[model samples]
Target: MGHWWDRNIIEPGKLPLLLALAAFVLTFLITRVVTRLIRAGKGPFGNVTAGSVHIHHVVPGVVLTVIGGFGAVASGRHGFGPALSAVIFGIGTGLVLDEFALILHLDDVYWSEAGRKSVEMVVLTAALVGLLLAGFVPFGVNDLSEDELQNRAGAVVSIGVNFLFALIALSKGKARTAVFGVIIPVVALIGSLRLARPGSLWARRFYRRRPRARARAVLRAYHHDRRWAGPRRAFGDWLGGKPDPPHPLERD
Candidate 1:
């Protein structure tokens, strides 16, 4: 075990990354627990306020992120400084991303359906970082043989092709696929080859003239959402908390 750790983690200079990922996941979980408790009115924790304004955690998160980011840059790799800075950055990232919906919408949507994006982003981030920890290289470069890498042109072409597929997937509204595809090119290819989601850029531009294709795309999207939306929402609610009920005025 120690040998594996040293060879795969320490020797490879992945300790700080590992530490950062651990800190990031832990901080996010703790933040969710605290926020959930506050929402339930069962904890001493409450919103932070200054004067007439309510200060959000994102403010402090920004400060810490800047500090840790700079510190990491100055500290270099393979040291206590890097490890400490990584942890600080991870904590700050957790706080910032916890309220990503607020930043995105420029409003406090923490308990709204839109707020689910934050949890999804965090989950996606953690999964990607976990893949990195598992030594999955970006752009499928890791799959190339040493001889292929030695051919610089070939490597560049391979990466470019992978990037093209990823872009196509993104345009098709396969965000998760596009993101993961950066590390696993086959996923990107699959997403790119699949039909675009209804209302996606690919569907809007390409399927607009094809009535049959448009209908098929819409049908597929409906079925897909129906199959996963409930479980997805349930998981998000369980991990974060149930969103506040919508107001009549806010409803159609």
Candidate 2:
């Protein structure tokens, strides 16, 4: 055991770690971008951003999964095993959170959106719990070949997450948006492993498809609001009874 662990499993490679770190940084930036794009205003980007509250939150989870997966793979552990499993865990966990959040009415403070999110969250959360426990638990790192476990876990988690996301997206879709989002992630998640490429490649491409116009704008707004605190910001902060910074456009 020690011989194999030392011989085939542990290798000195900074490439994977570098790659994972890059993915993490990219994920945070990309998430901010997506959030901004959605929140910029009521054009295509703004609408997408608002609607994305339903899907966009998964971006961080997906990013983390890829980082973990690639790190495992780069460590000279096994075929694309750890990375893939991590992806599954990521997507699955994201989905579970989304669904549960919605059902629990944690989607927002507003009553209407919260109601909708609560119901959706309940149904999806139940489904996710059942699927994950039954399918993904056995495919741990210590058990199967690295790639096999990763593939299995990735597939299970992605499917579970996408299933929930797809349900919401499709049911309330605008010209099949859900289908497009699901396809992009699915193809990228599965295909990247085969090429021994990191999943962040897909995430980067996904966000890159449209420049983060809204995100950039929102960031600008956020900064502006921070510099010049005003009446509206004060009122809003008071109303919310929370010392949160004002949104840029919300300032005045």
- Model 1 clash pairs are none
How far does residue 175 in candidate 2 sit from its true spot (Å)? Answer: 46
Model 2: per-residue lDDT, tens digit, 60-85?
Answer: 56465566555555646456655454
Q: How many backbone clashes does candidate 1 have?
A: 0
- lDDT of each residue in 1-252, candidate 1, tens digit only: 999999999998889889889988998899999989888898799989999899988899888889889999999885589999999999998889999999999999999989998999899999999999999999999999999999999999999999999999999999999999999999999999999998899999999899999999889999999999999989999998899998889997
Q: Estimate every model's Cα lDDT from 0 to 1.
A: 0.93, 0.41
Q: Let me know the TM-score candidate 1 reaches against the reference structure.
A: 0.97
Top of the candidates by TM-score: 1
